[model samples]
Target chain A: MTADHLESRRREIVLAALRCFAREGFHATSVRDVVRESGLSAGAVYSYFPSKAELVAGAVAPILEALTGVLDAVVLDGVRSVGEDRTPTEAVAEVLRRIYPIAVGGEVDYTRVAVTAWAEGLRDPAVRAIAERTYGTVRGRLTDRVTRWRDAGHLPADVDAGALGQVLLSTLLGFVLQHALLGDVDLDRYATAVALLLPRG
Target chain B: MTADHLESRRREIVLAALRCFAREGFHATSVRDVVRESGLSAGAVYSYFPSKAELVAGAVAPILEALTGVLDAVVLDGVRSVGEDRTPTEAVAEVLRRIYPIAVGGEVDYTRVAVTAWAEGLRDPAVRAIAERTYGTVRGRLTDRVTRWRDAGHLPADVDAGALGQVLLSTLLGFVLQHALLGDVDLDRYATAVALLLPRG
Candidate 1:
């Protein structure tokens, strides 16, 4: 097959897997589910992705990248330099804004997969590796931001940045869980409440 | 069978299901898994709990009651008369204190089950019904508290109680998720961060 044919086939497989993951969850779903969902033969599916782990990884990679991209846009790029007078809540508001669309507003619902990944991570070793890495990276970035905020005098000197960071990340993760499971979970209101918690400039 | 014997057998079946649910997940676990875990025949299991739904409900009712009890301890009973000087953070702290042992300290790790319930609720209609009621009730209580705080002048007049309540519930839910999955998540630090977020006395 041509290179374009191979790429298209791979995309088709990944999309099919995303659907199954979103509906049945990453761990509960099997390779056969992807095969059945794709309307492609098991052999054809296997030829592209070797196993269930690889299949889920393949399907989830883009969503992961997109989620990271959203975080990077807010946490990494949205932060102003020290003494520039940026409130932590402002960056947070941006993060939630960028997250809402990706979490539930797409052809593939990322948070739905995310909620499963968090749950399945407790029991599935393979899935746990992915979850731990992602969670660690996210938490580390938030911690660094919190430290930066404190250093810049946006927050008090005695504030525990690490603890604050964990709670901050938890709030976001909690929002994703609620939004994924409950159809009408509003982000704007949550964001407002979060802003109230942060120190105003 | 004697009443005591029948009750004991029912408890045995429910306990078996809880183990399976924690290991696999409520939506993913089969009644056969419960039977196998119980070391009892399928007939014996069915005689106690007619179906998977009823089985999970039986398994989770106590945990649910316990969770609500924690909430009630803080949100319901912990609240003092208007003009009584209990900070919102104090009530939150008490709730966290009560919740720690129940969520991760016990023989049955409830937050672990809770994480799965949130994920499984997305697709399992039967599970979804239970989840909706739980989340709806929790959010409603939090919202009511926010309104009470505002009305009592604990919070500002302009604060959006519904949104604040949602975020408040999210923070707690987020704490549960982290605690269940990460194994070393410090509720004390999280509680501290939560305390920082609430209005100071």
Candidate 2:
């Protein structure tokens, strides 16, 4: 195959592997499983990814990149809207609403893998690095937003922006876990509760 | 084996399966692996728990029971202190302090399995029954505490006790996930943040 054709094939195998991994898990999944899921022969699959870890890494890196993009957009939106007519809580909640869908969409698998990696990564260095990078980017973006709000006096004077960001991230993760466990369509009620958790001036 | 010895051997197999499942996952682990971990013959292991599902159920039921016991202690402590001289926030924090270790203990494997079961239970009726029983009891306890606080005017009139309990539960789960990921040792910080989320009188 041409280089471009090979690259496309690699992406196909990666996506298929993620679906299998999500349904089962990284360790439980085999090369044969990915081959069957991708409708590719064993040789064709081997041509793209060398190992299962490589396949997981390939699938996860892009999803993590996309999630970071979403988080960055949220932070940028908050910053751009800071000087606008809206209150800081409103801006923060608006950013949150933008983020809630990503957690439940294709990123649902991402969240699953991320949580698994977090627990398993304690022993697996390669997985741990990927998990840490993803978490750091997420936490960093949140800390920046909280810091801005604190500077604008949108929070209590003694508020620790760093810790508050941790709180917000923790809350968001909890909501996502609930969604993962319960297939509910009405998140508006939960969203309102989350909005209340934001620091109100 | 004697009946009592047989029962003890079965418990050993289930606990070993739990460790194996936690270290790997439900799908990655096999009956052989569990037996290897338990130092029992594979046939001996299966004689007690007929299937992996049964083994999983045996392993997790006690963890759920323990979790409910912790919730009961929290609610009972809150009720006992209801007539005592303490702020609502302080009382809630006290209960949280009593319950935080369950999130990050040696039994964390059981917690992981519980989480996995909770998510999978969404689609499986049999598993869902177990998940619902586990969640309902915890939610009921939390609802009781939040209701008590609201009636005592420790919470604002605008607060929904059920929603507040859900939020608290969500926050606790999220914190556990974060700490599991980051190796955070400070439950006190998390409990304090949760206290801040509750409505003040």
Candidate 3:
């Protein structure tokens, strides 16, 4: 296969694997399942993903990468999602908005898959590494944002930015968990709710 | 067996099931595995749990009940953990302190098991029902506390107590998710961090 063909083919297999993993779970899913899901021969699936573990990496990496993409827009380059002048609550709500797709949008809700990844991470080191990296980045970005909020006078002068950031991260983490399970709250309502707890000025 | 003997025996089986479920997962565990874990015969295990599904209920009910117990003491009977006059942040912190063992302290770390339950909840309706009832209770209590905070002059006059309450629940839910996965961030630090966002006066 040509280079483009190879990349796209790999992507195809990963998407199929992700669907299976998300719909079922890591423990319940096998490479055969991925093969059947992909409509590709077992040989073709095996050529790209040697085992279910590789398929897990294939499925989980992109989900975490997509989260990083949102962080890139929301945290690293605040210009993409919202302005520096926006309140921390607005910025957070924007982050959730951008990640709405990953969280609960589309046929495969990656947030649901992300929770599955958390469960998988408990037993699998590779999944653990991928998840751990994203969480670290999440915690770091949140902590930085809290510091900026304090420096910008959005939060109290004595607020512990580090811990507050973790709490913020927790709030986001909790949102993901809740949405993944119930998916009852829409983005606007969630934004309104979380805004009450965050800095306004 | 006598009624007391049967109850203790069931309790023993449930504990064993919880351990097995938490260590591995719901899909991975079997009635025989729980039987082995309980060191009881399959007949006794079956006599009590009947099946792996029942064993799941056997395992999950107590965890939820324990959480409800904490909420009862912390919310309905606020006089137990902290005074009603305490700040909402302080009360939330008190809730975390009280539930520490359930979150990340104990050997099984019900929080971890809770995550597994969440994973199982995706596929199992029984687990979902038990998990759902607790979440509803949690949301209701948190919302009630927020209303009290607003009425008691602890929050802004214009704050939406219902929405703010969901945010608070999200924070606690997020705390549980993070603790289940990372097991970092002690309760005191978490309390300090969340206090900054909530009403202190």
Candidate 4:
């Protein structure tokens, strides 16, 4: 197969594996299941991913990319839209509103997969690296934005950028936990509560 | 066996299982491991718990009780201490400070077990019931306290009690997630960020 064809084939297998993991869970879904779901031979699946951990990492790559994309857009928009009379709180709230639907929306079950990955990360170093990298990337993006907001006088000088970023990220994480564990939440009310965390001008 | 003797034996087995789950993992640890850890025969282990799911529920029971006890204390203190000139925010912060050490401390690893339980809850209905009931109890207690605060003029009248409770719980949940994922957080900074979440008096 050509390089592009190989890459496409890998993507196809990873997507199939993700569906199985979401449906049957990481521990319950075996390589055979992935092969069955992908309609590919056992040899083909093994060639692409020798183990379930590698398959999980492959499946998770797209989610990390999508999450980082959302963070980048939100941070950039927060910076660019300041002149349009938008508050940082509004910007953060907008990010939550936009991301909430995708994180908890129908058919995809991203939260379940992410939660499973988190649990797996505790015992699996490979999965831990992926979880840590994703968290670090999100925290770094938030830290940068928070620093900018402080320097630009949008937030208080005493605001610890790292802590603020964590606080914000925690809100998002907390939202995911609540959604996954308890069912739907009132996003508007959640957004308002989050806004209360912002420094008032 | 006497009822008291049977109760103690059950506790011993559950503790052994908890250790295994904490050290290994829920999915990785099996009934055999629990039996080995507890130094009991397979028949004895089976007599006490029919399945791993039952063992998980048994293991999680104490943690839930401890959590609810903490919440009850915090909410009661938040109410009783109001007359002593402490703000509700201060009461909440105090709770975080007291709980932070225990939640993130070494050896016990409540966060890891909780995260594992959460992941298990996704695939197991019995575990899911335990997780949901614990969450509901905590949220309900928090909602009651928030309502009391608002009614007493400590908080704004318009604050949604349920949302505020959820936001606060999310902060705690977020702290747990961060601690479990990243190891240690600046609890002081986290406490300060949490204080900022409360309405300014």
After TM-score superposition, what is the CA distance of residue A104 in candidate 2 from its true location, in Å?
Answer: 4.3
lDDT tens string, model 2, A72-112?
A: 66565647556443433343455547655655466235555
Q: Give the TM-score of candidate 1.
A: 0.91
lDDT of 2 at B56: 68
lDDT of 1: 0.78
Where does model 2 exceed 4 Å of error? Answer: A1-11, A41-44, A76-96, A100-124, A154-160, A199-201, B1-14, B40-48, B76-96, B102-129, B147-163, B199-201
Using lDDT, give the best candidate's number: 1
Highest TM-score: give the candidate number.
1
TM-score of chain B of each: 0.90, 0.80, 0.87, 0.85
Identify the runs in model 4 with alpha carbons over 4 angstroms from their true place.
Answer: A1-8, A80-89, A104-107, A151-156, A199-201, B1-7, B78-90, B104-107, B152-156
Residue lDDT tens for model 4, A101-126: 76657456777887777788888888
Cα lDDT over the full model 4: 0.77
Indicate the docking level reached by candidate 1.
Answer: medium
Candidates arranged by DockQ, highest first: 1, 3, 4, 2
- Model 2 achieves a DockQ score of 0.34
Better of 1 and 4 by TM-score: 1
- DockQ scores of the candidates: 0.66, 0.34, 0.62, 0.59
